[model samples]
Target: MMLDKVVVSDILSRSCVVTDLVAGNKVEVIEYLSQLLFAENIISDKALFIRDVLAREELGPTGFDNQVAIPHGKSPAVRETRMAVAQLRHPVDWETEDEVAVRLVILFAVRNADSGIGHIKVLASVSVALGDDEIVEQLMQAESREALYRLIVNNTGL
Candidate 1:
């Protein structure tokens, strides 16, 4: 069976991409973005989704290199896969592999059954887009939500 390719634009919307976000810590960051998922009608239960995301974080920090943190979880509460990207006004501790404060937070949620290859493909594509220095630089310096959304969608070829 062939599954359609998943890309950033598929999950990310202009309304969900936030700039100058004011989050003090990792939990706050996730909480803020999770609200976007609920408001966008992607997740049915915000609290449940948040709990799952936090649990996934406990399993292992999603923070990686390049001051980027992609915090995500798979839960039954998710009605559809979605993403919210936030550019913080100031970096926050995410217990990243390099111990660098994360300036960009990309939050994603997926249906519980998607915990297979489909899940890996989605995350890998997002990671690959973020791995590009020019893309990351553009995202970090993006001044508006529309611009940020465009960057993600265009850079990911979604």
Candidate 2:
């Protein structure tokens, strides 16, 4: 899939944004984001989805530098590719690269049977956007769910 052809807004909306997220640990953050996907009708099974996410985390931590983490899972429990963005009320330990507590979490759920490249496209787009220090800084500083959504959608040109 072409990088420019994928837009995060296609799967992410203001409804997927969570501000003032209060997660005490990595598991709490994953479960909270998994529930959000279930609430949005993106995932049919919350338990399975959360399990897959945690399983992925066990392989390796997704936490990047600058207080950001991208925890993702591809599972049959998901009906479609979806993303949830959260800004924590306080940083939580997520085994980050820099050992800095994670304050921003981006969670993605993809259907296990998905054969198309859409999921990969979305993931690449998000990774690229997060790699930009300016964009990451803006995301970390966003005060509201609406602001967070706007920053992601705008920066990713979604």
Candidate 3:
């Protein structure tokens, strides 16, 4: 399935701000997700969940590009596979080969490691969507969460 189809407005953050790459990589993922769970009161101890997700991040960096990162983990902290997309207010140092800061972070949480294939497809779709400069620009300038969702759906045909 395409990311735009799976990514909802409730899971999209438009004004995330980050100063450093490491914090950006971790906070962008955990904060957006925590907000989602908080809104639903689905999970308690957001810090603990963030720590677990960061532990998964230590296994490898999720910074896929200068502009994007996809951090994910398989843990019970997530009841299902949730995908949260964030557009940072400013670029954060992502420590990539391109040396460009990351403007977007897509955090994925899956129920099982065996279900990674589905996550891979979502990541692939996100990569394709980010390839177009116009799409990227539109996403960056998206004024509202719903606008961002529509932009993604339009680009990914979801």
TM-score of each: 0.92, 0.91, 0.69
Question: What is candidate 3's lDDT per residue for 124-152, written digit by digit as tens?
Answer: 66668877778888877877666766776
Candidate 1's residue-wise lDDT over 1-158, tens digit each?
63556666666788888999998899999999999889989899999999999999999879877889999888899988778899999999997877989999998888876666755777788899888888899999999998988888888763
Model 2, range 4-54, lDDT digits (tens) per residue?
355788889788899989878989988888888888899999998899888
Sorted on TM-score, best first, the list reads 1, 2, 3
lDDT of 1: 0.86
What candidate 3 gets wrong by more than 4 Å, as runs, is 1-29, 41-45, 113-119
- Candidate 2 RMSD to the correct structure: 2.4
Predictions in order: lDDT: 0.86, 0.85, 0.60
Query: RMSD, each candidate, Å?
Result: 1.7, 2.4, 5.2
- Candidate 1 clashes between residue pairs 3 or more apart in a chain or in different chains: none
In order of lDDT, best first, we have 1, 2, 3
